[model samples]
Target: MSSAVIDLKNCDNCPIRHRAVCARCEPDELEQLEDIKFYRTYDAGQPIMWAGDQMEFVASVVTGIATLSQTMEDGRTQMVGLLLPSDFIGRPGRVRASYDVTAVSEVTICCFRRKPFETMMVTTPHIGQRLLEMTLDELDAAREWMLILGRKTAREKIASLLAIIARREASLHLGKTGDGFAFDLPLTREAMADYLGLTLETVSRQISALKRDGVIALEGKRRVIVPDFDALIDETGDDADGGLLS
Candidate 1:
């Protein structure tokens, strides 16, 4: 399929624009991004970069979903990160990818040549500061996932993943209803299993159990409706009185 065209004019309205590379940049700095940024698209299931492959650019998701995964010698794989629209991908300083990046859905990315981007970041303090902030947020998310993998129960892991996805989707204005909302589950059972450190059978079983308990309603295999956000979080094994961010 042909790649989707990215509208540069929409950059100002992007949810992450202020929180990402352009956050601290002057109008002139944004003009530089317009000059060097280009669009690339990947089909569903396509590998954007392989582990240890040389990456020539850094990118941010313009549309659709992607995943970062690492595999062991024996073929056991773990999903380390999920990328959504406006989420940055690839590394500024790294030449070789540490994990395999794959498009979980048809995806469009805003790309910049690494050399120019690196130089621009150095010359632009705003962009550099924004990138540092984003990196720190990603690091925190990675540590949260580590806790999930190391400590949470199967049901709690599944709940935590669903809660995270729902919160992000809602933040992106993809919610279907009020605070109680519905959205498609972007990952497959096997993908969920990889992310949550469970067997596919276990993932399937837990999803079914959640449906049975009325914590979530399923319109189909991929569609989910959460009627009570707090209840879903309760299933995640977080402190009952704590807030979502806690």
Candidate 2:
């Protein structure tokens, strides 16, 4: 979320280079993708795409975070997913979006026209295969989210959500390890409440509890510093060892 303007010409040095949709492409394929690719930026809190809107393109988040949420006719809203750097923005073959996607922070996205990208997916086995892998990972995360909603205590939910974002931020910036790192909380208390199925008061209280217990440290309202990422992970109620039992 820097104030500097973006230039789209340098795809080779792009920050999310290894994790993006074109991660597996060869030079020739990447050249072709560059020919069709475009970049767009959204300010924090801006709506990127509304639910049921006809999507003109698919995108990969180049930087920053976004939220996928839904709104009812009566105006009730729930946050359903998060889009981090390297996260795919739209589904192939889907012309209309099913959820409202809004920028949670200053954001930039690498975009591909939907029809042409769909055609590329059909012709390029590597692209299709990689996309399938990403899709499966998304499915697994979604199921884990279901478990979080249905089973986790309120404190565990906050810890789990923090761990997820911290891990992604670390991967994007500091490789895969999360220790001795800091990231701004992408969601507001209200948004976290919606995403975690808790009241805003509950979200605030749990976060305060984590801070009190030294699982996390906060600078002002949003910045989170993890002195020991392992400690935070332990609070998430997940297997600390990721134990393999026969």
Candidate 3:
């Protein structure tokens, strides 16, 4: 864990600038944000926020991955979601965090003081509009996860997770997905199993199966290379365009 510093000098070169909550901000509005923004970095496996904790700021993920999980009364925890680059954390008017946020990899976020951010949201229509769009997208993703967990087969589930990560990585870097695109798997097999509701053995087996089938290649334990993005999408059992056939 580390504290914040004034580091807005690189805002123009920020990788997630076009996709983040500030995407719609005008230059003047961005300068307004810079006044309140600072950076926070967390090491892998660090807890960013615990459920019910007071949230002093809202942020956008600048890099790395994090998980949103909840612990039940019985002490069992479920990983409910992942936050990738450009993902927003905290919400306007929210005084406390709802889930446990943990870093799955080394993470960096650009944070704004909650009070100032909330005030800016009132005067800045673009910020409010973009947040609403992201909220809706989150809702859609939650519904899709319900389908994946409730009905998808083990192989399909693994494929779906891979496709999701690959797509997000591509969007942040290349603006698209295609053959020969490579990305590092941020989660270990055990974590993948926990997130997907499968056994570690099952997670390893499905990954091996995908490799054997030539749907993907592995440069190492964590680096996954897709030979054909379409094939991986096929394995996910999802519509290619994520829409009803038209």
Q: TM-scores of the models, in the given order? A: 0.89, 0.87, 0.87
Task: Give me the overall lDDT of model 2.
Answer: 0.83
How far out, in Å, is residue 147 in model 1?
A: 1.3
Q: What lDDT does the true structure give each of the candidates? A: 0.84, 0.83, 0.85
lDDT of 3 by residue, 130-235 (tens): 8898889999999888888899999999999999889878976865586689999989897798688788899999999999999999998999999899999999
Angstrom error of the Cα, residue 239, model 1: value is 1.4
Model 3's TM-score against the true structure: 0.87
Q: Clashes in model 2: which pairs?
A: none
Q: After superposition, how far is residue 187 of candidate 2 from its true place, in Å?
A: 2.0
Model 3 gets an lDDT of 0.85
Error of 1 at 64 (Å): 0.8
lDDT of 1 by residue, 73-164 (tens): 99999999898877888888999889998999998887788999999888987777877888898999999899899999999999999988
* Candidate with more favorable, higher lDDT: 2 or 3: 3
Model 2, position 166: C-alpha lDDT score: 87
Off by over 4 Å in 1: 1-19, 174-180, 241-246
